[model samples]
Target: MAEGFLTTHVLDTARGIPAQGVKITLYRISGMSHRKIAEAVTNADGRTDAPILPKGTFRPGTYELVFHAGDYLRASGQAGDGVLFLDEVPIRFGMAEDTHYHVPLLLSPFGYSTYRGS
Candidate 1:
């Protein structure tokens, strides 16, 4: 069985490398309201050093992982002012069980995709 935790990773598809220094924010969502639960920045490996939601804090609910893609790309010299096509990318997903949630994002300056990963 998968461990109970929430995690994420980012890849810079345009650069063909892991997206480092990307700011990520985790939010719990309810009807018409979103509450910030945690925030992290990607390390050299394009992943947070620790789980955004650790095992003890894992819960079943609707959550969103917002990636500051524009800032990251700009900082990495992949995008420029007024030229970035994609900015904050929000991946909203539902967690119904106490299992691991690995949401990985493949990103570029103009596009992005995500999937439920192992």
Candidate 2:
């Protein structure tokens, strides 16, 4: 059994390595609104092997993953001005069953992208 229901990873393309200490926030979508779910940080490997959602709290609905790009870049010693163009990265998706949702971010100074992964 999974301890949580959501997961993510972050790769700093500019640095060509896994991004550590990136702040990630999870949210639950409610009709036309959103509710905060949980937050976590990426490990040294740039991955969250455990679920982001609280244990035994899995449900079917839309969710969002907000990545703090600017903060991460700055913390990693990159200049804040114009560095890491994307300030906040938000990824919204849905869950249908008790399954693993791994969202990995491939990021650079001027751009970033993510997708559903195994």
Candidate 3:
């Protein structure tokens, strides 16, 4: 098996730019339990300086990426004073094989998208 790892990036679809300063949390979920495993904050390029789960640390299992987008939306002047429609976006997925998993977030004030990337 090839080395396995996990990474992520954030794109602001509405502004058409990288989303900086977005907080991300990784959770390892098993049955009814969710354990916090890692945390990262996006930099100027909307990417973590390092992989959230690096080689030798990554495993095939159920995971969740919680993107704190409300802070970014408010900081970018996109969110209104009322409650946000997309605040903490939780994307739950499974890594079935040992390879590379890039789960990116395409974010906007009202919605978001994510997928398995290269």
Candidate 4:
């Protein structure tokens, strides 16, 4: 284990702008167990700037990245006052070894997608 870990970015696909003020929550899961690990707010450039996981925090298991899409789209004036297709988007995946996880969100008002990155 190292001293720190993890990072992320958020891109507003519809508006072609950096998604600021988006809430990102990280979770650690193993078997039937889950726990909140960390949280961060995207910066002006749609990135956390600093590391998401602190040093010596690496662990091999499942993880979840929950992005507050609806709130951000509304704040950015890209979405109207209605039920959104993407409210709180949860991305669940597994980590087999100690490595850096760059989970990025490409979000739009109608749809969204995510992928594991370097």
Candidate 5:
């Protein structure tokens, strides 16, 4: 059987560029427990150098991806030093054991969207 993996990317919708240097954290959620599984930072291409959840380590369960957007917004000049409207953005989802998941984020200063991609 083919094992699954998880990956993500960020795009700066307002600036029409790839969001670089964004911090990404992965968590495995079960019942009332949230356990951090992995962490990554987006490179210049708006993607991590490696998969957040590699194929061999994949499992079927609920997961969450936390994108630290406030820092990136400030550094990219999309936001000020003041408190941001959107700080840490969290997307909670479930995955099957045998499907590759590509979660892409289309982000702006005040709004963001995510979808399962190819």
Candidate 6:
């Protein structure tokens, strides 16, 4: 695919593995209004089967990726009542046209981090 697209991957930092079957939701953000765009579950490689925002669909604006971390961890047998700190992890970023946006998340039950990738 060309440069103007949005993609993501998730890694389970604690288990040192790709976080499969994690529910991810994409949203277009406009001030206080959040509109859902798309939703997908991570595959075996912790990536969506297709780009979140394909080339023709990409636009310059703010977007959010909400990762259902707690549920994924619980399903993987990693999270418990008091041990889970993060549940729905939201990564918000601004995209520019004609540029590839790869937002990868390194996550644990208690903490997570993300960055803009090539």
> 3 or 5: which has the higher TM-score?
5
TM-scores of the candidates in the order shown: 0.95, 0.86, 0.96, 0.90, 0.96, 0.92
Q: What is the C-alpha lDDT of each candidate?
A: 0.92, 0.82, 0.94, 0.84, 0.93, 0.90
Tell me which of candidates 4 and 6 scores higher on lDDT.
Answer: 6
Off by over 4 Å in 1: 1-3
In Å, residue 11's CA in model 4 sits off its true spot by 0.4
Residue 106 in model 2: shift from native, Å? 0.9
**Candidate 6, overall lDDT?**
0.90
Per the 3 Å backbone cut-off, how many clashing residue pairs does candidate 3 have?
A: 0
In the predicted model 4, the residue pairs found to clash are 2-56, 3-54, 3-55, 3-56, 4-54, 4-55, 5-53
lDDT of 1 by residue, 1-118 (tens): 3458998999999989999999999999998899999999999999999999888887788999999999998898888788568999999999998888899999998899999998
> Over 4 Å off in model 6, which ranges?
1-3, 81-83
Give the per-residue lDDT digits (tens) of candidate 4, residues 12-107. 988898899999988898778879988999999999867666558877778888998889988888778988878899998886766677779999
Q: Cα miss at 77, model 2 (Å)?
A: 3.3
Candidate 3: worst-modelled 10 consecutive residues by lDDT: 1-10
lDDT of 1 at 79: 82
Quick one: ranking by TM-score, best first?
5, 3, 1, 6, 4, 2
Model 3 deviation from the true structure expressed as Cα RMSD, one decimal place: 1.4
Which parts of model 5 are misplaced by more than 4 Å?
none
Expressed as tens digits, the lDDT of each residue in 8-46 for candidate 6 is: 999999999999999999999999999999899999999
Candidates 1 and 3, the one with greater TM-score:
3
Residues 6-45, model 5: lDDT tens digits: 9999999999999999999999999999999999999999
When summed lDDT is taken over every stretch of 10 residues in candidate 2, the lowest stretch is 77-86
Q: Tens-digit lDDT track for model 2 on 1-118?
A: 5444777899999889999888899899989898987888888999765678855888878998999888987777765666455789899888877777778899886788888888
Clash pairs, candidate 3, are none
- Judging by TM-score against the true structure, name the best candidate: 5
